[model samples]
Target: MSAVVLSVALSASASADMFKPSKAEQMKLGKQAAAEVRKKEKVLPDSDPRVQLVKRVGRRILSTFSEKEQPWEYSFDVIESKEVNAFALPGGPVFFYTGLLEKFKYEDELAAVMAHEITHVRREHWAYSQRDANKANVLLLGLSLFGGRRDVLSATDLLATFYSLKYSRQHENQADSMGFDMLVAANYNPDGMVLLFETLKQSSKGGKPPEFLSSHPDDGNRIRNAKTKIEKSPKEFPALTKINL
Candidate 1:
């Protein structure tokens, strides 16, 4: 092969390798990201009673799921902002905005949300995205140095972010399923998921919805999906009254 072709082949191989970061490496990067996020955003200490309560409930739900054994640590915070967003970082760090908690009429509903976020960590979706981002970064660096255009590097970064967001949506769906299962296993109301989604949908109709709802695809179809799943698995649906606050 010509030198140019050989170089291209080498670049492709390196790019391919970039796509596969070891789980350890991905977790390391995710922890780094979480630290940065904490610095910029208000994160509650796990020591607080309220935070501990969240951890207790979260742990109970997480126990039902099978995932890699990681040092899972859960934290709760009441963000002063009205945004209803909640997320979990790869290694086990989780956050729930106060806006979401306040909207729930019962503790079981809150458990549903917590279970969903925990599912994200348990399923390793965040780690997968981190691996993808690492690969994209590597590819972009290679293209910047090689015969590829600089504009391609910029485009790659943009595309990587978009891909990350798409993965996030998929993660949300997987979490939804896993979370429902977890709630059922823990004997929390499975309908809480549907109710939470309906609340989100209703909240979106009046004025501007919280950032969480805005960033996420509206709960319209998701609400329906949750309900359908509940209907199909009646045995898994626990009595809402059994959940202790």
Candidate 2:
């Protein structure tokens, strides 16, 4: 099957993934998962304060994006759960648990979460994961936009289950790096992101770790990476000298 290289707006040196799901397929899986989650999880309404906060922070991160060329549709939802977890469906559905929401003390911290999750969807990480796992139930169904009914259950499980949703370390790094750019582009303090990593590190319980942090063991490395980017302060922002963060 012929496939086009879907280049992501990350570091230019980062190699793009190929032969992944189409935009339509990813959207379909996302819609399917969205329906399933609404039925099974206690998703908060837009009227809820927490949900409102998430949307506000999510918009901040999203506003910095320049990829109107892509067909992905972004949606943010907050679920009433204590688990410190948040994951993104292939198309653009990003869910945040109440636990994660309550943990953030600043808008920047929340923006980091939104930025990271959005990056996963923007970069089509799930489609690449399906390719690695050979899970045709999720991959061949195509990480589409909507209208696909095939493997609906599998796609739903892929979004809700830890095993299916865990991104590889490399993908995690890319999301962090690219997400940093998004946060900075929005003119928010990038240090909040590093603070989030520290929050995760300090909050991990029982050595088991939350599903979100369990997949990647290198939290320290990610923190270091964020600091490095801030220190380097590329030409994108020349006022770096005045910004304390």
Q: How far out, in Å, is residue 161 in model 1?
A: 7.5
lDDT of each: 0.63, 0.72
Measured with C-alpha atoms, the lDDT of residue 121 in candidate 2 is 87
Candidate 2 segments exceeding 4 Å error: 1-19, 135-154, 160-164, 234-245
Residue range 1-245, candidate 2, lDDT tens digits = 21421221122114333335567888888877877888889999989888887787788777766777378887889889888878788788889998877777777777777888888888888887765543333234334323543234456466656334677888888889988888898887888888888888877856556544777865478889988998898634322212111
lDDT of 1 by residue, 16-135 (tens): 544444455445545655566667667667665556666777778767655765655544454434666666655566666666666777667778888877777667775566556654
Residue 32: error of model 1 in Å? Answer: 3.7
Worst 10 residues of 2 by lDDT: 4-13
Per-candidate Cα RMSD to the true structure, in Å, reads: 5.9, 8.2
Q: How far out, in Å, is residue 149 in model 1?
A: 19
Report how far off residue 86 is in candidate 1 (Å).
Answer: 0.8
